[model samples]
Target: MPSGAVRMSRKRAPEPASQLGDVPERKRVSWGILISQGSWADRSPLHEAASQGRLLALRTLLAQVTPVTKGCHANIATIDHVTPLHEACLSGHVACVRALISAGANVNAATFDGITPLYNCCSSGSVGCLELLLQNGAHTRARHAHLPSALHEACKRGNSQCVESLLAHGADPDLKVPQLGSPLYVSCLHRHADCSKILLHTGANVNVGRGNDSPLHAAVRQDSRDQVTLLLDYGANVNSRDEDGRRPLELAPPGGPSQQLLVSFQGSPRTLCQLCRLRIRNVIGRSRLKHLPRLPLPPLLTQYLEHM
Candidate 1:
């Protein structure tokens, strides 16, 4: 249109969407483009970064997700009632947890089985995650399909720290579930000797037995010497009978400290176990002693003789 110089040709516009050739086979990305693309590297980077404690990489990848999709993550299923938040909390993924919470994930979401993320963390000995979930308003009283509560899981796992944290956050140790008795019963029944001690110190029921028997009955059935000792120390009724009329002593071997069962019942079968043991001990001791050469009594033997 002018004489001074040749006019430059106009650039052609981009082809219309319908004119593209099968979308040019869209390059398979190694990482997600908005969502994860068809690239294993894309999916693996997050896990690898997390495993390596690469906080910066994790943050970068997480930040790429658009705000619209932020709260769309779910690691669990409708059938199982679990979520990614639950897994992260249970596995002690502190950074992932923080990211999930910050992304508006539901902290109190329960699994199909009624287990919350907080319960998993407590059961798996993740005190930090437990605290995190509680701080974010995770319910401590949430129960699993078969579990009682976070308190029950903590006690069952023998995690005293988790138990303390749950209690401090207002968990009910005595909260009774339908099948399991109390959190204390869960502790004693699962052979958590130290947990039982803590529960007892906190006024948990000493004789509160669940299932078919009292806690004493459960202790004796396990034949856990430490549990038996603890229960007795806590003033468990040694003579307390279950539905089958069995005492704690009935479950013990003949020589256990509680073998006598220590209570009398009118018109009931008398427990002569102590007399029977004394007779057996005396016969065995005398037979063994008769074979030994006469010697001066040692200090320990003198003490025993004096006690006898």
Candidate 2:
């Protein structure tokens, strides 16, 4: 009608009834349109943006979605039951994860493979993302039998900061998975001395571990003097036997330093100071152990109790 306006003519608007077959997903996502969660793996543009750490695109897509679907897109699961939050967390995209979470994504959404966003964040060692999920009420512990514990994932990955965050948030330090054993055991098994030390400091039972195997046994097998010393300091049971009826000393390589340390520990006693430290920590309670410095005790005594 207008001189500057160009009219586009469609020769055919409609064909036969239901004769065009199924439309390609891209057909629905034509130019200038932003759509998400199609019929295939159920992945949306949001999932793509979140997974690739495209923060700008992710925000833009969220902006284009309708009000009802804006927050929902952050939560829609793929065929694998993986949300965009999962993708962003797994990829360690803090800003994207924050965006998804701010858009009302469920912080505790678990995948078909028993992974929560917290678990993925810990696995990726992104403390920022981990903090975001935790602040959003992500379960510090797995709520379902199918969901793996985020603390265990952190320990297995040797992420002490993540482990500490989970612990500080009330995660069970001694949670024992049937296949993975205790967090302490997995940390020792993986040679994560720092993680094990943190677990020990947080009052994890030194002698408890995966069925019949002690953290000491894991440390002995690893032949790590640091692990052995740390466990010994925490009063790990040297005489503890595994399923194979073997002691930690037996697991160490013959004539190795760990074996020699175990030999000395077998016949000797822990110092009065070490015993007192352990007793004080136990009496202080795990929940209150973090406040040891504020108890008006001597700073040196407090540091000793906290293993500082």
Candidate 3:
């Protein structure tokens, strides 16, 4: 198969461990049975153990297997190219993940669908597994060709902890997928206010999105008043229009909170203080906004600068 290509195997229910063959009663077993029988199965025993978070079984398998580089079974993939590492990360089994990585599993291995172990960790909201992958050199920016970035996946799932972990590890919040636009856009679409806040605080481009659909546009479409307020606080352009030429206020449903809030903003001019705060935040840039608390200012003034 071509690199990173996934091939679907014939559908078959997972077989029980009893049918795989008997082994000597010990903590660790030989790889001969796993290699002989699992090669033709949908997944290897290692994959099953990792996916189920069977730490002891995983460790025993790892101990018995030779180095992956020597054609050992550590990095074995299923018919669909899903590795044990992928299984472990997908299931949020940190111990199995660490064991797989220690046994020389490829941390950045991509499956047929282009989903990397790091991406699976984010999709599963496994912050521990995600961090373990990053610490072991998983590519933070690895894309699945068709799927969104790891940051986008975390935001899509409304996983603020995963979002924070990805950002702290240098994942780009603005990295646009073909249809997903920016992570902020996805967060707003899902009404994940906390994720949106984190993305904005981390310097994501508030105006970036698919076509003309800015984060503000998405927030309004979702009718999330809190998200709209948060976006406005972070300097999102209230007058920004979508692809259909409808501004955020125009997109708001009639008589809804979003509409009410938007109408109010439209009727009343922004305060000079609010405008100045927005200007300062814009000038300082999103990446540097976090440092506002350390500036030589009073606590109240610093809170204002941080938009607290």
Candidate 4:
């Protein structure tokens, strides 16, 4: 045997709950070891096998564990207030999630901080977990501490599948939180083209800028021609001013490829946001009305403004 290592001839089970060190009282538990040992759900042989990805073991556990435990929503050590189902959903273990849900696990159970199983999957971009949660009646519009809706996560990460899934299930694309704005705004700020497109198609306010400005301003700042065009085509105002008296056109970086100045219809800086909305809505409305081809700016709008 090596000087520092001891080799055991027999396999050993993990430390029992009682023999294990003290379980701290906080929030957010790690199901890693419990899932690793396969008995995290109550020392059931089926749980052990399921933890190991044993399909038959999972089926058997789904049929057996609940009957024995009477569908108890027990905590896994690492997760503060989350049950085994939360861990499964957070880890994207679809089968395990299904088993837990089938076993009467509360799909909407939240951790102490308001994190939910759906939030975990959404933040991680796990479509499988998302679908599982949705199918099991998960709250599609649920919010959590420090996190917006799952749609916000999907938009921020540019996860098309999750966005589509959430929208199809009636998740409000226009939903807003203090930290993250509308899904369209988040997508625009992050330059997530597909996600932004999806949000626009789903009736998100393309012209409604987030925070101090609109999506047009965000696209201009990033000099994202594609995103800018998409926003414009979908009804974002090109002339909308923010709190700083800067129009989306004025905020365009040193390089961009579109220049169109539609003065605020109301011609009032006090209502600049509304003016920008109107101009953008009119442009987009006309385009839609006439079925015009997508317009591509001939040169960066910033450079054009310099000449004017």
| Candidate 2 lDDT over residue span 1-308, tens digit each | 33433111001124343543453322221201112213334577888899789999998987876886767767878766778898788678999999998888999887765778898787778899999988889988777653577888788778899999989888888888787889999999889999999899888999989899999999999898999999999988888899999989889999888999988887889989989988888887877887777888888878899888
Tens-digit lDDT track for model 4 on 16-111?
A: 567444532111133323322323233344334433445566666556545567566332323245455655654567877777777777778776
**Looking at model 3, how many pairs of residues clash?**
2
The CA root-mean-square deviation of candidate 3, after full C-alpha superposition on the true structure, stands at: 8.0
The RMSD of every model to the true structure, in order and in angstroms, is: 21.7, 13.7, 8.0, 12.5
* Candidates sorted by lDDT, best first: 2, 3, 4, 1
Which pairs of residues clash in candidate 1, taking residues 3 or more apart in a chain or in different chains?
A: 75-84, 76-82, 81-111, 81-112, 209-214, 209-215
- TM per candidate comes to 0.61, 0.84, 0.83, 0.63
- Number of backbone collisions per candidate: 6, 1, 2, 13
What candidate 4 gets wrong by more than 4 Å, as runs, is 1-68, 73-79, 143-147, 258-308
Winning candidate number (lDDT) = 2
Regions of model 3 farther than 4 Å from truth: 1-40, 67-72, 143-147
lDDT per residue (tens digit) for residues 1-308 in model 3: 23533222112343457854453221112122223333445678988898789999988887885554432577888776778898787668898888888788888877665668887777778899998988989888864545646787788878899999989878888888887888899999999999998888777878887778999888888999999898877667787878888898888888888898888877887798988987888898757776787788899988777667
lDDT of model 1, residue 11 = 14
In TM-score terms, candidate 1 sits at 0.61
Model 1, runs deviating above 4 Å: 1-58, 68-70, 74-79, 143-148, 257-308
- Candidate ordering by TM-score (highest first): 2, 3, 4, 1
Instruction: Report the error of model 4 at residue 293, Å.
Output: 21
